[model samples]
Target chain A: MDELNREAESAPLIKFFTKLQPLAPAVIELCEAHTYRVKIKKNALLVCPEAVCSECLFFIIKGAVRGFILDDDKDITVWLTDENNLIGNFRNPGIPKMNYKEHMQALEDTELLVLPYDLIDQLYAKFPETNVIGRKLLAIHYHISQERSILSRIPSAEARYKQFKETHPLLHFRVPVKFLASYLGMRIETLSRLRKKSKQENNLIG
Target chain B: MDELNREAESAPLIKFFTKLQPLAPAVIELCEAHTYRVKIKKNALLVCPEAVCSECLFFIIKGAVRGFILDDDKDITVWLTDENNLIGNFRNPGIPKMNYKEHMQALEDTELLVLPYDLIDQLYAKFPETNVIGRKLLAIHYHISQERSILSRIPSAEARYKQFKETHPLLHFRVPVKFLASYLGMRIETLSRLRKKSKQENNLIG
Candidate 1:
């Protein structure tokens, strides 16, 4: 596209950024220039383990994805996401080198707005306000990661399921039970049993 | 307390900030004006669950601290830190309010440089380049959290132990076996056996 599409597709992303911090017109224009939309088919790999450092961050417009690392031939789910979220290489883009340690697969047909890492670095360097957004996003992600770290170490299966359900009420039903179980650090069977028990309790309450 | 202490105590902190990015004389001066050192006695609470939002971040000059949440009367370790590390309320200081869900305690007599949240917010507002340091720090903390998330999900106790020892070689011997076991999501007994097995293997190999 020769011209910037600011009207429709970029509106949501602009909203996302402004919600974090107001952007100068110049910063907005820069972002509008570099960001573009991508639609990924269901089961497509958004980020493969062998993928080179694309060094781009994705803002989830719609659909779902999972981040996992392979261990002993098994894919261990480390992160799960849906709409209105951001995912990236996670390595600092300012650094000269990076290697992908996780694979990101679209669990459903996905739409994302891709922003190049170089643009982000440029924005931070060129605009002071942009760093507020950068800092806030990183803080949010760090807090989330810390929560997941705590969740993984939680001792009780029921507790873990409950916490997951509470935090991801929509995803609880949307995501396949197996992947959810893996993300919760439990076996599929255990999660299934917990779900059955939870459903029964909900039915009684209802 | 009346005047800025720029010479001796602040050197390590200035060095730390400069390593992230060369600070402007003004930003550097502002930092020196606000940051001061505190020494915490061993076994004392640096941050308690009921502790008010101190709104101060600690850069660990020496000793160790663990961040844990009370679950069913059990304090589950959520984070562990040592020298040259940062620990805080983990809440965005820009926010008007916060509630502490974690307790931080000094594992040994600890020294730390305290930087108030207000000064941090001011830095991001006044000096654009300071945001780089903020972004970089958050990225690092987020990456660390992500790694911990993965470590907590690793299935095998031996694998977890091996990974922890590899990553935190000094912590392996320095931290108590129980806390390390808890952090690794293994019982102390299981960790002891793993350690015994590891030592035996090393001995045979040696």
Candidate 2:
């Protein structure tokens, strides 16, 4: 096999593997086809809050997903996963068991490459590159978690939104204002005011 | 291979895997060997924050490990990886092109089983079952990141401390009050007061 062709074949798996480093072809191929490729309609619930998430991690192959938690009929978006990104409600808080306390929903009609925990486990046990993949994925989730923490500590809500947009421009078009507001830990009104101010400052809108 | 020996070989790897899991033997063998014995003196730094972590992950074969985030002069203990727990900042947060901002230290004279990331990656690519182990490890890290988020939102400092103890009693004894206090998002004074109040509540101080 030519070197270029070999690199090309392995590129897709490693392209997203910007962390923990690249994987060998064997680890990438360990992925089974049983991970059903499905189309989810806009606002379709992939997993409901407090529900058990059997497949908590999957790639956003062609659409966007919002992973959020519910509070008193309100949805507070925690993380948004756009195309080429990964999303899920695989983690729970104050709980001993592995369960999902948040929900995942499609922001648009989405196509995803799903990797279930069961199969991932199987692959992880057998493949070393998959282990690297695991580490890279963990790094991603960690950054997002830290972003949330930093946003909370930054004090000004406007600064929070600015930071959010700077770090996650991919989310702006996908998530609606109300959702974005809540995700930034702000009220819809505060978000609206900030948006108006930001637009005026940038000459984007008057 | 005899069933008895195989069982002995696979069990340690299995302990770290906390999801729908089973490990392939090649992975188990790789993992078992990669885990080399090491010791640290009390008050010694096991892992310096901001260095590219060459260590794959350290299993607390025995002794205690305190993983902390240094904010200015203060060290906030975010996690404690004790007996049977495998930990490293790289796996939890991902190490892509460096820029890590945390440190892990020994709270006491600690014994560790250190594995290099590259060695594990090689094993996973070669062994089918280890791929599953890789995925499971990610699951565990993902869970930790999620819990940090949830715990941060526990509304008050006192509640966070309560939850921390409930979840990580093993770590509480070895870790100092101040570090644990910072991790709970509280001031040292508040933690001291809480401990005093708790001691008085049961009349144990007398």
Candidate 3:
């Protein structure tokens, strides 16, 4: 990427980190030095099932990615990431376990900042502040995972869909309905029916 | 607690931290100064629904605690922690959101080292090495949570139970069967049936 283009691409990520916690100039410089940018086409798989997941963490500059598992030929969506969100397999690098039985695929043409895990480790060793940032990021991720686990047990498909919509309004427009439905642990038919009913209700309100 | 008893109790926790990554004497001293011990009786709730969760991270010394959510009188177990594992709310202190719609209950009489979040923050600010330890701990937690999420999607109850048993042999003996069944997202009857079948198979092998 060219200088101006690179600057534009990194601006959102810089803003994201600063918002999480103020990053020192040195930390920012470390991030800039260690991170690289990539663009993926829609439907491209970022991480594949049974493969060693890349040790790099990704910050989405634009577009969306979805994580899904194939169960007896059925694709079940596990998670979705949108602009300004980070996505990566958080498994310990030391463990020789097979990569998770899930694939991360781009839902749209996407731009990402890839920060390799080795560089992150280096940052932790060289800059203590990065470790603080790392903790904050992981805490947020853990909180979200816990919330998703709780929501998965809600027992009502419609309620689950509504909660998903409320929590991820941007994703509603960015992700296909089928992926969203599966992500919410519901049938595509049920999601369609709910969408139609919701549209009618909105029309009546209007 | 008496000084001698306190010292004995904290030794395990100090060992746990040192094992995660070496802690300087000053850092260990900081932890010792900031942490306190708690004894929870079996069946007592450590955290309650809609309540502000204590701003303390808990290191399990002995016994078990299970995190569960009540849905229309049905208690669904989300997670279980055993000896040497750490548990914490990890919710942003500034966010007034009720600390998750879940409660953590002691499954057995439990001993814990409670490190207040503020003290942890101070440690991170003062001791850079603590930040590295914090990140490692969170990374492990994040990995486990992701694994659990993946495991929950398994279609067969027996398979899930088998995986659970393999992964948490100690918990199988320590936690009640009902909680285990709930944690596995299976009916108690099914869990019972699976257990009997597995026992019979083991007898055959013997």
TM-scores for the candidates: 0.91, 0.64, 0.86
Q: What's model 2's overall lDDT? A: 0.62
lDDT of 2 by residue, A1-206 (tens): 45555454434434676445655656555443324455779989875222333554676668888777654444557666677666765533223531236778888898776556766667656654565566557556766665455344344578678877776766675688877876666678999898888878889644
Model 3: per-residue lDDT, tens digit, A60-130? Answer: 88889998877667687777778777888765523322244667999999988886877777877787677
1 or 2, which is superior by DockQ?
Answer: 1
DockQ of each: 0.52, 0.16, 0.41
Candidates, ranked, lDDT: 1, 3, 2
Off by over 4 Å in 3: A1-3, A47-54, A70-75, A91-102, A193-206, B1-4, B47-54, B72-74, B93-99
The stretch of ten residues in a row with the least summed lDDT in candidate 3 chain A is A91-100
Q: What is the TM-score of chain A in candidate 3?
A: 0.87
Better of 1 and 2 by TM-score: 1
Cα shift from native, residue A88, model 3 (Å): 1.3
Chain A superposition TM-score per model: 0.90, 0.77, 0.87
lDDT of 3 by residue, B1-206 (tens): 56566567678889987877888888877677667778989999874222322567788888899988777677788888788888867654123212346678899999888877777879887887787787777777767776666566555678778877778777887888888888877778999999999999989999
Segments of candidate 1 deviating more than 4 angstroms:
A1-6, A48-53, A93-100, B1-5, B48-53, B93-100
Query: What is the docking quality class of candidate 3?
Result: acceptable
lDDT for B41 (candidate 1): 91
